[model samples]
Target: MTGRRRWTTDEILGTAAELLRTSDAESFSVRKLAAALGTDSSSLYRHFRNKTELLRAVADRTLEAAMDGYRPPDGWKERLTATALRLREAFGQHPQVAAIWGRYGSGGPGSRLVMEEVLQALRASGLPDEEIPARYHRVVILVTALIASEAGVGALLPEEYEQGMEQFRVAVLGADPDRFPALSHFAREIRPLGVDRRAAFDEIIAAHLAQIEIAIP
Candidate 1:
């Protein structure tokens, strides 16, 4: 009988992160991870209680990478936007990871560290103390939604996605221009564009920052 290979916690976590980068949660399984590692499926339980816990570990590692080399910005709005952009880039690298972490604000060490940075920036800003919590909540919700949207679309490769857009255009492009002028005009501009998650993220961040400005008291 063959013996099971010993795996280090760090190695397990690293592999889990890679698995998330290449695979979505829908198809990623502990058995698949074990196969990838050339180990028994049950052995992963030594490092993680279950799939959720393992993926949470992966998400936490991603947070560290996301904020790596990060420095405090000159002003609070700059701070928020800078952090937001880094997080978006991180998601771009591992789109599936976004959905996992977004569902749970479970506050692993890396998550707590990032949140502290945000709070530090908010404190330095002149926004009223009473309004800080609500503002923070809104920022979290908006950023998470944007990341999730990006991740969902990323289930396919870029060329595969572009093909999907072409197929959709074929389905709907036959609409009479006079009857649906708005759809005809806008579909041409937007459909080929596909999911510009970063652009959508920037627009909402600007709107939210505007709200932050109004909250200053």
Candidate 2:
């Protein structure tokens, strides 16, 4: 007789996650996933009753991968920045998974754990218990907003966009010196600094967290 195969839940979720990472969520199917795993669709159904449940599983796994083993730093600001940056990196690495994460409710176990960590961090910083929820929400908003912005959606422009910026630079510097003294003086520095995008993101997150600390008290 043929031996029965055994598959752990992590194995199933990991396989689905790998597929989702490479392909769009819309194109992923249980039959295809099962085939990829050397099993049949029935086996997948046994693990996940429906596609929605499967997606939740996928999201849970993805978030766990994103947050697992992250240790907060000594300073609250640094810790907040680290958390935000890590979250951004995770989402950016798996754009498809990030899209799914943004849609789901944060009531999932992984999501709750993340919130707990944030609250604990804030409380450690001397925030009152009553204010921890609001503070946590602000941090979540900041991180999520930065993640959405960093997704690079609608930010890239055609070659003409670059040409337009150049033209604007020229027009400003070419104007009468009296009209735009600052532009004339710093025309060279006015050009894009070509800063590393990831570093710039970290700076922005750090700045935002600093601001939050001031407002929290």
Candidate 3:
């Protein structure tokens, strides 16, 4: 009699990742995964010791997907921006992955390798060897913070959120025009700046590069 083929760890992980992307992570359980895979829940434990380990593996796989096909450009600034955008796109597509990314130490192989490349690029851009690590940490922290914020808050906002802010600013300035002369004079400009996040990201990257250049000499 022919033996039944078994599912490999990669298949299991890949399937789980797909589920995560398509559904909420909280909704994914071993039973559901097994049902999706046409197997028993117990089979997954053979590959992953527990649910947490499986989740971690899923997160690693997600990071790998994010970093896939990322090649650095000639200029360090360009490379940094590209890497950040790649990560952003990856997390934006699979926001569930971002929830756990910050929970783990910044030592996952994929994340570490990306950081190492960034450090190398910073060094090439005239940053001192001793300072590269710190600067790299800063870059990672800043980019990840942005991603985490998006994941946690999501894109949804009440229709009144912005309008409410604007109303409050105008009301406060109108109530005490002399008390808040600057705010009253620049009420429109003072209302949150309405900066496009992509533009802000580019500006932050440019500022970092400028700092690196200044520190080089």
Query: What tens-digit string does per-residue lDDT give for candidate 3 at 31-120?
Result: 888888988888888898777777777777767777887778888778887888887777776666676665553345676667777887
Error of 2 at 79 (Å): 1.6
In angstroms, the error of model 3 at 124 is 1.0
Off by over 4 Å in 1: 1-5, 191-196
Inter-residue clash pairs, candidate 2: none
Cα lDDT of candidate 2 equals 0.71
lDDT, model 1 = 0.81
Identify the leading candidate in terms of lDDT: 1
lDDT of 1 at 181: 84
Q: Give stretches of model 3 more than 4 Å off.
A: 1-5, 22-28, 105-108, 153-195
Which structure is stronger by lDDT: 1 or 3?
1
Task: Please give the RMSD of candidate 3 to the true structure.
Answer: 4.5
Clashing pairs in 1: none
Q: Single out the weakest 10-residue window by summed lDDT for candidate 3.
A: 152-161
Over all chains combined, what TM-score does candidate 3 have?
0.73
Candidates 1 and 2: which is better by lDDT? Answer: 1
